[model samples]
Target: MMVPCALHALWRTLLPVSCFINSVLAAYDEPQGRVATAMTLDPTPGKDAGPALPEAFVSYAFEFSSFPDFAGNSTSGPNLFSDQLLNNIGNITGTKPYIRAGGNTQDYAVYDPSLPVALVGVIDPERQPNYPTNVTVGPSFFESYATWPGARYVHGFNLARSNGTYGDEDLLGPVEPACRALGIDDRLLYWEVGNEVDVYNRGRFAVRPPGWDEADYVAEWLNATRRVRARMGEACPELATDERFKLWAPSYGGTDNGLDAVRPWQDGIDADGNVVEVSMHFYMSGYGLPGITLQGTLLNHTNTAARLAPHLNVSRALAAAAPGVPYALTEVNSLYNAGQPDVSNVFGAALWTLDFNLWCAANGVARVHMQQGLNFRYASWQPRDTGLAPKGTRPPYYGDVAVASAVGDLTRAEVRVRSLRMESETDAASVPSGRGEPLP
Candidate 1:
């Protein structure tokens, strides 16, 4: 049976970057489709029914890590809380809501690591499983989007020896409370340990702490999952439900994401358990946006997705090695240019987003999170100068989905695009190494 995919993961990897362009252009010779009818993309806000989504999907993401920092400013306004972010989310993806936290932020924080975690919403971290930060950020985000009809969540916990597990624990501190806050604790989809630990010190990534080993990760994860198991055992007494927890890892880039090179954390959960999901990330392009006409942008894109296939394949294979646990590309994106208005705002970026998501669903990806949709920020390629949101709309804005809604629905059709590519003789190095560090 061909099980349909929700979405495929997208991320920027050090693929055998194909610079050839003229040869890879996709043949849009099918006599324009309904979407291509407008001169430019008519992404302008058009009524409430926006467009039907391809599938009942979850808009995976890492959009809310920062809060508006306007302290004591009596601007005498609504003080843009979580609602502002959720407002746009509901207005956009009008179906099953899916979201993840921890985009380009550290898992551990300034709080004391030695003491028991003091979570705001969920009572005990052990009982709850994966809870992040406090209610201020988590609740704010949840409250904003939770009412989105049928929303679900994937929480990435903190892991690092300095605080919980230098690269262990799958660091599930703040996950529980966040789920409780969302009121979907029972359906608390999946959780990840940290962001791309494979490409350490590369892009927007921090260094692995002292004594960070693969075994250490498995051990810490064992301890944390035990708590979750204990909680599950305790649940039957109160009307029985398996709302415990699942394991996820490496949170970034499909290739290494740290699990493959490092020892697999197959400590607990037998081989047949559908409970845990070994998570990773995926992205494309070095933060800078790629340009491809309907008849262009093939070699680079295809090679980019293919290059990371090994990594994704490794991730999928982990399910076999550490059976029972499913595989997932938790964090993904076409580029790291989150807030960069130029690259992220172009129709090109929008196109990339659609293609990447479709790719994830078609490939073996279990789930995908598009960094942070709420708090869009410029990534490595954006230098220090770039706007947050685009002044006007072109692509990568809200309307990027009209196509996603279309393509995401056509899950059965094997996407076959013939592109015209002008190949660049150089390799991945041909693209300038941007500022952001590659993920660990």
Candidate 2:
């Protein structure tokens, strides 16, 4: 399942990032003695084909603490490397990739006006070395949002600080500043209150008690979001309308982890009807989980389908309950815990990236945000040179560029994607077929 040496050399020359077209054509080399399977892509839309996707369908989610590093402030200037990479995709897809500045650290962040630096964080290696556990952001942190031109963002607020209690002013302290910073110039796409609240009852990062359930989560969410909306109304009254004042809700880790995905919807998580989209987080496998291999897990089309089935089901149920509300995989990547070292950073992951995104596009997921960090093994590119890694494109980034190319110019016409069924999960032809017009 490793990328052939010939293709590896081609990936190295993709500095301009537009060379994905040439590299993708030579993406696969058939193994000896393997039979080629026929895949018939019907022009007619199937029962499972999703709606026309947005122009910026493929996007990214950065670790909350690393936002300053990825998007340098006004003083240090913008990260030209990041802008170049994003703009390259925008050239093909007709829009720059949207950036979501949130992850585990988002819940841990607190605002401090006096701090000189954009952010000051303390990383506990035992919990997670990829990002900080306790994060503080100063007034300069808002400058990072202004760095990336033409890119909309979903700013995450501190939800975990409430610590299972509602109406905690400390938790609401960051809302006014964030609203004032991003509410202008249409730069804000949506506001996310938390990251993966479903797993807050257990694990090393648990913030809620053992008895906490979906109902408790719903109550807390309603209270906090209502207060957030009221604060925004006072801070930025112009953005308090139905058209703009929407939030990405629940931000669950999975369908059936500590909390069931559908239960929150049933519990009236969106009682105010301001929830514009449903957000979910996913990973193909954990970093040190057993029986995980690039070939059997990441590159296996069947495995991808299996992993996505539950999420798709949740999406379907949400559509039934709240029609027209889009569902997105706001936080997702190949492996959790900053990804596996060799398996996630290699060319095989590039192949996995294509299959994963195409499958999601065809299966009704509204958007897919591949999660990344400063030195995460599965990052599309290392934003800066650190002791652990260098500042350069990784193998998976080629897959991202190829996806943008496959999507083509969305501004010209509506795009519909359908996965062509394959006889084998390991078959190289298991890619989706996309059309520019609505399928009849």
Regions more than 4 Å wrong, model 2 = 1-48, 163-169, 423-440
- lDDT string for model 1 (1-440, tens) is 01112221221111110111111222222224523211121222223211222332325565334311210012222224333433344444443435565544434332233333221232234432222333223323333333333445555544433233343323433444444544443445555555455544343334554445555555554555455444434433221134444545545355544434325444433322434556666655433455522212322344445655676567556756765544556655555544344545454455455444444544545444555443343221111122443222234433234323433332332221111112221211111211111211
Top TM-score: which candidate number? 2
Q: In candidate 2, where is summed lDDT lowest over 10 consecutive residues? A: 2-11
Give all candidates' CA lDDT scores: 0.39, 0.76
> How do all models score by TM-score?
0.56, 0.87
**What does the lDDT read for residue 230 in candidate 1?**
49
Which one is best on lDDT?
Answer: 2
lDDT of predicted model 1: 0.39
Residues 1-440, candidate 2: write the lDDT tens digits: 11101011111211112122213322444354756444333445445556677768889999989888888888789988988998998898898898899999998888877889899999899887778898998888888888878889999987888754544654677777777878767788998887899888888668888889999988988887888888778888877778888899889988878787878888998888889888999899899999887767775555677788899888988888778888899998999999997789998788778767766876778888999898899999988889988999999899898777666666665666654432333233122221111211
- The RMSD (Cα, Å) of candidate 2 is 6.9
Question: Among all windows of ten consecutive residues in candidate 1, which has the lowest summed lDDT?
Answer: 14-23
TM-score of 1: 0.56
